[model samples]
Target chain A: MNKLLRAGFSRLGRSCVFWLLTSFSAALAIFMCAVCFKNMNAHGDAVDAGQLMLNYSTLTGVVTAIFASIYIGVDYSDGTVRNKIASGHRRFDIYLSNLTVTTAAGLFSYVVFIITVAAVGIPLFGSIIMPLPRLFALLGCIFAAASAYSGIFTFITMSASSRTVSAALSLLCALALIMAALTCLGVLEQEKEILSGSVTDGESGEVEFVYSPNPRYPTESERKLYKTLLDINPAGQMLQLAGRAEPDFKLIPLCALSEFVAFTALGAFIFRRKDLR
Target chain B: MEYVLETNKLTKMYKHSAALSGLTMHVPKGSIYGFVGRNGAGKTTLIRIVCGLQSPTSGDYTLFGRSGGDRAIVRSRRRVGAVVETPSVYRDMTARENLRQQYRILGLPTFDGIDEILRLVGLEDTGKKKARNFSLGMRQRLGIAVALCGDPDLLLLDEPTNGLDPQGIVDIRELILRLNRERSTTVLVSSHILDELSKLATHYGFIDDGRIVREMSAEELDAECRKCARVEVTDAKALARTLDSMGIEYRILSDTTADVFAKINVSQLSSALSSSGCELLTVTERDESLESFYISLVGGGRHE
Candidate 1:
């Protein structure tokens, strides 16, 4: 197991893609911080720098997911998995090693992105603060999203033989989940009405008809379907945590934690028994 | 006298096709065992199964006296190296790095013997060049070097010279002989190149349709396939009598034809035949090459 870990690390260490993604995420976070600072100065008001930093961290989770999928998908496409099996490494070990590397890379990118956002945002937009529990919960959400994405992407990469097909399917599946979540939350219908120019201001011209959709008030069957979609969609849970107007974040972290464990177990189970060749 | 590998009714099926059906073979220790077969004869399948790359559908095998199902079998397999099909190598890694990766996989203490292994495979000067840039023959040599990582006593080479040039073939042939003769490594090499195999194999196993049709030691094969004088005689009884009186060994095919195993003085035999009232009609000396012998064993060549 130690040897397997070392081999995994060695491969990951030499991968130019891993470092490239990390640097890109850090640079993007810095850019996002600068944008938030510019907006705050234009408005002539103090900005919550930590909020912008957290937004960058949230984006890091999504980017890490994309990177993990591509990294693992390329190996499957090139038939390297077959060579690894032929070389006497157990199938489980190979899968685990790849998963570990991708997960670690994702987590590393998330950390760097978080640090860069915080470093630039706190000084430029004023000292933004968070309670200890809220900070821990936010970190939990980021880690959970990364872990779940790792599992889902690994499963996708192994199951599909072609990298293009895998990438397409991964993106399609992610979009489908987000679309389904928005429909369940009644957000899509409201957006559709707004886009079609049907939404209008009242007599006071206060934009009282501005729509906010929430599936929390759904029919029992729709609620059940929404719950099922939410259960599998890591991105849905992430958006729920990051985009909530109210700061109620405890359940989001707990949900993310459950997802992390469930997806990891599922990925490992399928990977161990898969015929690599 | 102990055999290094013994299989009892080993069988494997891929989907609806039977790749290896009841293949039972024994390879003795310290012998260059040639696994002879035509293409698609299950040579690679058998080697893959034994190397733990694939599972056999049924039956069992023992390596170094350890049964295939035993944990010790996997442990013993560590001492058995194989190059099945095309070489299994990372084309991006240099020869030295390739060996280093293998050593790491095997959990060797250090890369102390890597230089020696490279020299043994004639790849010592490959320097930092990756295997992808190597020629087919060079890749094959590096594959052998990967197999030699742990100094395995048993080496399984499947068609090692399959696509090499004549000189490259000779180099591999010489290397296999040197490995066997000097290091006493037991080799089980599979090849359709019967003549090349004949040069290296101390024992031969002829496989057809996934089963070993024949297995014989070199000396037994030699005697069975020895060249002899084939003569046609007018009188079989008289010819037999004359040969018996002269203390020669021969086999009479019919009243007209017989094979003379010993080299005979044609004039003396002619005089003997004349005294015995037998007429010698024709004399054709024939030696059976490995190709012809293999064809005879497996029926006419599949091509013919």
Candidate 2:
């Protein structure tokens, strides 16, 4: 057990540089969010601070996912995975050690981002802070997102032939997920429909404008569809939290937790069966 | 005496191709067992199986009388160190750091004997020098140092002298000899360099196409490789009669040439031949080298 822990710690220690860089980037993003919030307040604009914070957090999540891919991907690219196995480490231990290091780094980066956001928000927003339980719940959602993303990215890293391919695929997957979520929410449906019509007509056609008043709540069927989609789409829950007038801490975090478990288990299963060579 | 390592019809197949096909061998305790085979002859596969890096597909091996499938096989393997194909060392770490990491993996209590191991592999002075910057020979030495970490009694080295210079080869050769002679470490050394193996091997197992073609002791190999005098005589029958009378071992090669195993006085041999109605034409002494003997044993094209 001590040997296992020592091995885990050694792997974690080697990735300290990644943690440092992540913290620095999170700090920069938090600073930018503060400046954006301050500029909007100074202009007396009714800006959604929560949404801005969510965007900033999402950016950090994306960057952390990329970092995880590179960190674990390098060993696979360099034939070190085979070497470690040859040195008598069990496959489970190798996967678990890498997972532990990635988790620690992700949590470290998330904590740094959370602290910076809180430190900036309390001063500028006049201490109108979210409740501690709610904040912890929100951070739990963020941690789940990070863990699930890292797990999926770890699988990608192991399966990829090169670091470049792994990084590209990770970025592509993250972008595809975000874009798919936006498309599913009907944000791009009208524009897409118009483009399809134009291509069918063999000419560039103009889209007609249709104005509708903002509804106070979604229809029952639409709400049911959103819940069903959230169950399958982990990122959708983050969007739902960002779009809500009041944070639905219970629903969003529960969905995130389940997705986290599912993806992590899937990743572990895929990694355990892979041949090191 | 119990064999330190034994394979019972071990076979391994990769997908549709068979890498090892029923290879059976035995290495006696405290003996320098030379594993001789050509390139791609399942030497590394066999070593990997014994080292627990791989599993045999259709057979079993026993280490220290413990079968590979038994629970005690791991304990038996704990006493074995191997350098298969290439020396496994972290190029980013220093020699000491590499050893330390290996010690950690092995769960050793402390770094007590690390210094002595370094000195044993001639890397004692490589302080603070990372393996990446070390010369190939130094890296190879560091690999041996890592293998020595657990103080294993059985050492498996596969093609240790593959890429070494003459001096580097000699250095590794001397190190292996000293370890076996002084520490009584049983070594299973695989090499294509038959001449070099002949210098160190107490016993030999010749593998060809993933099968053991022969196994012999040093004395037996020497007896098989005896030196003889090749003599050309005008009358082969007369020369044979003379050799029969003198009780000398000789084989007739052709109408004019024959080989005699026993040494003889040149003048007396000529006089005997003359008296026997045969004229001595030419004589040349020849001794078989290990390489030639191996080539003859396995056949020439097979070695190629």
Candidate 3:
């Protein structure tokens, strides 16, 4: 409904959380840019924007989670949700409006951060490595990841009544998931170290060197499982997308987009059944 | 009678208790219907359900002409507004900002009525002051202002004057009366203060144990609680016979006492009683108030 959108957008525009997160993200982006510029000035070789973006997985994921959680949580704490429902707006419309606004805000702040970083990083670190279409695909992946994060955080906000608890839990859970995904990626990236086992000297039948293979490297099936976790987890997809892996349409992007759909639907469904009292 | 709201066997059950059990009542159009009940008696639950904040477990209700599950019911709800339990406002925002948020949500083309509603609720001067800093009465008035947006045909106020001083109570009372009398807006107000409701309600529904124990117009309630003469005599048998000959509506209380509904010449009754060999001991006029009437229905011993 138009009324729902108007109300939701107004709230989003005036939300302190939106402004705070935007500032935080802008500061982070600026800090990264300054560090890159300093590195280029001192070493004559600027930091790679690709590596800088890779770290955005944890940064953007956690920040968006905090933003979305606190944004929706205030509506519940302030009892404004009842106003919309009492005004004859459908529950689905209210939920959808919040989702749309939070997603849009998330995307907007992310773009601001991207532009701020690009303003410095492109000139110093060099232009984006990929072609135009490929860059667009990567941008799409980031947007999808941001939407999924919004859905998840919104779901948590609607499920819990206490704003403080919802925000803390959302932040903690998002970070925990990112850590889990990072650990899985770390395991996948472990290389098998060559260990000489039992080398015998040709002249004397004496064992000169003894070595064995490092078992810390993931097996093929274990590697598949870790890859699946990385693909399915929003934070993991964010990390993988940031890494600029051959942007095939199959894994990380699909996971992020599907999660966006799934979490939004699930959040809307739960909110519809929620009682304001 | 044209009813603005009607419920059929509405029941709401909590995990361990039933807040409302088979509550079926009607609010006639163009009347200030008072919903009287003690705490935990389903007053707020009924309001919440009708306002779409919660769902009735196993019942249906109709607003205007639309049933609960019908798509048109939403349109019907556009004609209704309610403040359930507490004022739903953003505490950090100023009063004007709060109303502006509500106005935008109500989809009014312009902010035309925002100032008008603020003036109507006596909050026009609450400029730049956040609702959290306003007094309780100011917040209450703001809540009513929010409900008054869109000029709804029916308004529901739940304990609108719960924590107000005498002047605040009078302000809210006068506001409700002015809205009803000037606008013909049907109001369903729930409150524990019977005397306060008595001054405002045109119709009364006495709810106890989650049921409507009585529903009547003000005139009917007045007649039931009207002043009457109480006469104590030596023998009610002879007094009844004497009053029957005089043709007065009366209720016999005991063998030696009776309540006489009509005014009578005490001297004539004394002379008639003496002729019947009965002594007239005393005569007193009495009228039960709304509080006593509610006690009679819900029992005088139980406390809210």
Candidate 4:
């Protein structure tokens, strides 16, 4: 296992995909910061460092999905996975080594994004408005969420035999998670009764607002389910971190940790039984 | 004789068909063992199972006298190296980089002998050239170089010269010979290219329908190969008629040539052909080829 991890990390260090994605992440942070800086200069708008820092969450999902898939899928496609197995490395060790490397890759991108955002955004927008401890805690949650994304995508890539299919599936899974999170957020954000429209009396030139119950609003039990889904889903947690709503800080990391463990176990189990050519 | 690898009724079943069914064979220590089989005859499947890339459905194999089911079998596998099907190479990386990666995986103390391994495979000067850009032969050599990283005792090469030019085939053959000669590495090479295998294999195991049909030393096979008199005549049809009336077994090579399995009087055959108004050309007696021997064993070439 140690040898596998060392080799995996060595490969990861020289991986073009990991470096390219990390650069893109950093460039994106710079771009976002520039846009915010331009807005502040042009319109005298306030910028929140916390929100900008949390923006890495949005990128983590897609980045981790693409990175993990390509990183792990190459083994199967190029037939290098056979080398590891034929060299007497256990299947579980191979799986876990991949997971570790991919998770580290995800974290690397996340850190680069954070550092880039802080280096540029702090000078332009000032320090985070939220307490330092609170920001750190949220950062930790986002890190956990990123690791969970690694776990999920690693499992998908490892289970798949073809690199092309695994990549497509992983990207699709990431998009689905994000869309599901947005849908949940939409449902949970609905008001019990909303202003539907304005009604004008026929006789008087006066307008009165009419209110109606939100048809899309969830029931009491349904609301709890959606909330729990939002808390558990990595993308949903990302949305929460990005200030879509207040995050259940304690539960988010707990769920992310559970997901990491579960997916790692399942992926290793599947890989152990998998037959390679 | 001590066997480096021994399988007892090893079986592997896929979803619809069995890839290996009650197959058994052995590779003796320090011998170049040829695994001869046609396509889909479970050659790669058995190699994959031995390499730990796939598990057998039933039965098991012993590597270096260790059972496949034992925990120490992993250690036993450390003495083995294989390049099954295509060469397992990281095409994106250069040959040296790929070797370094393999060395790390093997947990070698250092990348000390990579240059030597590369030189052994005739790839020492492939500097800065990624394996993707390499020719098929170079990539194959790189694959062998990677397999030679840890100085393994047993080497498994499956169709190593599948898509090679004549020169590439000779190079690989020479490299295998050198490895076996210098390091005393036991090699199990599976190929349908009987002529090439005949050149390298000291022992041969012929498999059919997921089972080994026969296993014999090269000396035994040489003794078993049939001898026949090859004859060329003016008219094969007339020669066939004369030979058929003589109650002799033969195979027609062409319109004017045939191999007679039975001994015949030269003058009698000549007079018989002359009586039929056909002239006998020439005759030479020689042993049949390994291809003919294989065809005689497996029944025929592939049927389209």
Give the per-residue lDDT of model 2 (tens digit) for B1-304.
7799999999988888887899999999999999998887888889888876667888999998899888567678768877767677766678888788778777788989999989988898988887889988887787777777788889888888888889999999999999899989999999988888988999999988888899998888987788989999999999999889989998898988988898977788899999988899989998988888898878888545
For DockQ, the strongest prediction is: 3
Q: Quote the lDDT for B296 in model 3.
A: 87
Q: Which stretches of candidate 2 lie over 4 Å from their true place?
A: A37-41, A44-88, A119-128, A158-179, A185-230, A233-277, B230-262, B266-285, B302-304
Query: How much is A109 displaced in model 2, in angstroms?
Result: 2.5
* TM-score against truth, every candidate: 0.83, 0.77, 0.91, 0.89
The DockQ-derived docking category for candidate 2 is incorrect
Q: What is the per-residue lDDT of model 2 for residues A1-277, given as tens digits with 9 covering 90 to 100?
A: 3565575466556554586666675777567666767786788654433334454445544665577677777665533454455445565666666766776776776666656665675556555344556555666666666666666666666667477898888888877766656555553122212222222233656554544443434566766675566534545555554553244566656666676566667766766555333
lDDT of 3 by residue, B1-304 (tens): 9999999999888876888889999999999999998887889999988888888888889999888878667788788888887888888788888888888988988888889889888999988999989899998998899889899999999999998999999999999999999999999999988888989899999888787888889888877788899999999999999999999988899999999999899999999989999999999999888788889888966674
- Which window of 10 residues has the lowest lDDT sum in candidate 1 chain B? B295-304
Residue B213 displacement (Å), model 2: 2.2
What's the TM-score of chain A alone for every prediction? 0.78, 0.73, 0.88, 0.95
DockQ metric for all predictions: 0.29, 0.21, 0.70, 0.62
Q: Is candidate 2 or candidate 3 better by DockQ?
A: 3
Evaluation by DockQ, superior candidate among 1 and 2: 1
Best by lDDT: 4
Model 3, span A214-267: residue lDDT tens:
689888899889888877888777777777233345666778778888987887
Error of 2 at B85 (Å): 2.6
| Chain B TM-score of candidate number 1 | 0.90
True-contact fraction in model 4 equals 0.79
Which residue pairs of candidate 3 clash? A196-A211, A197-A211
Please provide, for model 1 over A116-212, each residue's C-alpha lDDT reduced to its tens digit, 9 standing for 90 to 100: 8778777776566666566667677767766777667666765675778877776766666567655644531223223222454566565434444
Instruction: Specify the poorest-scoring 10-residue window by lDDT in model 2 chain B.
Output: B84-93
